[model samples]
Target: MASSDTYAAHAFHHSFDKERASGAITLTDVHVQFHNDQGQVRFPVSGTQFSLGGASDRLLFIRHPSEPDWNIYTSDLSILKHPALQNDVQIQRRVQQIKNKRRFTWGVFASVVMVLVAIPLLVVLFMDSLTGPLARHVPPEWEQKLGETAFAQYQMGQDFLKQEESDQLLDPLLQPLLQQLQDERYPFQFYISSDDAVNAFALPGGIVVINSGLILKADSADELLGVVAHEISHVTEQHSVRNIMGTAGVYLTINAMLGDMSGLLAMVANAAPYLINQSYSRGFETQADEKGLALLYRAQIEPEGLVTFFEKLREQEQKQLDKVAGEDNRESIESTLQFLSTHPATEDRIDHLQEQINELPHQNTLDLSLPFTTLQERVKRFVAKEDEEPET
Candidate 1:
């Protein structure tokens, strides 16, 4: 026990004795002195520490250092001889409760952090396998619904030829070419158009249209076969249908992202002119060239005729350029010759075909005789009669 006092400074010392019992603790004669600017005051703080025996025991004790000593037990307020000291213990307990609440808040914050980092990582790990199912999830009717819509849009821009042009100049050449290429394995149709753009194309539903200018431009039968076989490969592999489907999907997805509900409707309404630039992909072009050359070789036609056709077109381009300097007319003509587009240039393709031909054994010769000169004479006579006959 210790005690001290200072009158001028208004201070006093406190002292007490502590003892431990079976499940509680006792404090004897505790003296508490309060000092402020006004004055000093001394009091007796009385309490005996009592604990509820458990895994964790908390005990606090205080007592009065006076002759009339009092003992207080923390278990009950009535057991405390000094009620004022119990109030001090209650105030300390509230401060401790605030600290426990802050700790629980920190625990919740940590759990949220872990979830935020883990969820994306799990998704990335499984994404590859998930995409396959996602791609296949499109409805079964989507292709037909999309196909009809695309075809309608594509037909609006077509230019049909006059009936006289069809019977005379066009049908005479195409009918035989059609019969020559036909196989029981694949049935195809030939549509003649008067488009003079020097272009030819194939469509999804086995429709192959060739322009008269393209036929007149080809000097040899083998070169014409090369072009036909190329279009035939497009039909067999279904590249046109695949392209239409792919383009339509991309169009729809973009419009959907923009929140447009009528994208498909708009696409269907304008499909015909839309297909004008449906260029074959580069891989499809190469595949077609390889297959076309094979078909020519199988038909006993020399691949050199295809090469010769390209040479003639190149020569025509030079003459046209010399006549019209800085003009793009020749360039446009060259574009229709299969040399200036996604397909490999005719020269490069010829080199590859020549290499393949070298590896295969030569077949016994072929005779490809076309009667274009004789057919032209007959067509002139027929047209003259139509012109001489006046309109009814």
Candidate 2:
């Protein structure tokens, strides 16, 4: 047993005013001495008993019950283990209770913090997997509404060719393909854009648009039909709508997790316009290609038309690359082909289409008798007329 006189502790002393006063407390069998700047004051153990109040592992707290403002705190263990205090049951029990409560409180606090951090982390990690199911829950009518809004916004400043003669010539070529792919749920609306780029895109619901450049570039009516068939499949498969929802879902999930409703609302407001210009993922593009080929097979149109069109695009891409190989305008030339940038690699698509065609039973070549040359001439004339129009 260590002597009480040998057990002294450095501590902070507080009086009724709650001001911290540095002091050393020394313990003896009959009294406790507090030595500070003012003087050495003695507290008789018999007259002044101490109670432990919310102590920690590295610290001990003591105060007189009768004099509530008299408090002492120390991080020294030896003072509590002195011969004069070791046998006190009250002090031992109070210290044990404080330690237990401290551990329990820290455990609860740690658990709560972990749960708060983990919930958002888990959401972000699994967000990609959740996109499909969440997208499916969006109503078809909602998709149509989005599509209508996007189509209206997309055509705001674009030149939409509306000549009756051109429509008459183009409608017959598209009617058969539409008849093959149309369903009661989605009534397709087709549009022709006078933009001089080999591009076509589908909006959510059933809005499909084709560029005049693509039509003029086609070698045959079958190639144009194949392009139309591919875009049709995008609508039929709801790829456009699903792709939009997938993008918006990720955006919304992250913003919601961060507790930013303003950002989320802003995203929702711009969603339709953003989706109008967004490109589909490679997987969605592949699905469209496979389904488009199937649609052609079902319509008795040669699948080779799709393959041939892809081959032509690839050849054109190569020619463009060669032309810009050593030129300073290579970047500009590459950026001009927006269709190639958006679609999957042409070479891969061509190979896949050819593979599908090879699996089918051999058949005679399609009769390429459609007035493709006449349509090209008409497209050229319309483009020339548009170019002649003064810029507003």
Candidate 3:
């Protein structure tokens, strides 16, 4: 019963209703018709405000003040490309800018994470190569300063044997070795500590300290010379300084990459303590042993003394191990010997020293039997005197 024009309008409305239900909208007579989950709705653009929502390259997003959710449209849809949008240039530009910003933000975040993960890996993989060169940059004066600081810290609250007493015992033994080494680059000063640990260590700036226990442990002056030469080699080779710089360099580089400057002062403050307590790496120990043997050869001292000292230590360690009942007890006892702990007198090391000894031509070195015996007795008397004195 309807006229054809009325029927045509009704058909168009029916089609629009279906399209709007699926989140599609078209502008007609300055009004937008769309359907939300609530069903078909229409609003006049004159009263509604437009806003851009989330969008992608292939999709356009639009929001209206009357709607709770954004209405999505295909970017290539004719309705979106309509010339009518040109009148709302501000809205279109804002939408495009926001999309670009989102993409850029995500890209930057991903790139940052990737770089953060890569920096430490690269540093660790190339650490040796980098640290060797970086260590060379530390000046000799700085090395000396570090050594002095560490030595001062080490001597705190400790009873050092009088200089006169130390020289009387050590100078006669050390002077000939020094004369042979002929290294005048550093002022090498030796000191003896009253501590009963059979240990000797070299500071960065040619400062070597030997415990009285080490003096008592040596069988001959050549044996003591071997230990002194090894310690001297550590100083001459700048091993301590190199080690400190290498470790600090790695820590600083990591902190730098992370953009953290807060802990740098603390690290520097702890440097002296770290150097004092740090054990030399096996590579460093090997180098010192090789150079020490060479120094003994140059000094015309018997390299066999070095080998003999190590054998004695091995025998002593075995004796201690034999006394222990269980494997765990043996392990624990081995860990307690500070000399072996620090020097690590492994079988391979002993074998290597013997091989070096075999290559050397046999010669009669200085007869140090009498002086070494006197020194050992003196050390025992000094230790006994300390025990008799009350703690002040």
Per-prediction TM-score to the true structure, in the order listed: 0.45, 0.58, 0.59
- Each candidate: what lDDT? 0.49, 0.68, 0.66
Tell me, by lDDT, which candidate is best.
Answer: 2
Model 2 over residues 110-227: C-alpha lDDT tens digits? 9999988886677656654444454444556766777889888888788766645556667767666667764656777777778888878887678888888898877787788788
What is the lDDT for 390 in model 2?
Answer: 19
> What is the descending lDDT order?
2, 3, 1
Steric overlap count per candidate = 8, 0, 0
Worst 10 residues of 2 by lDDT: 8-17
Residue 121 lDDT in candidate 2: 70
lDDT of 1 by residue, 239-358 (tens): 554444345554353443355536544444345445546786556677767776666666666666666666665566567656765465656665665554665765666677677768
- Give the per-residue Cα lDDT of candidate 2 at 322: 79
For every candidate, C-alpha RMSD to the true structure in Å: 17.8, 8.3, 11.6
Model 1 residue 333 lDDT?
A: 60
Worst 10 residues of 3 by lDDT: 2-11
Instruction: Provide the clash count, candidate 1.
Output: 8
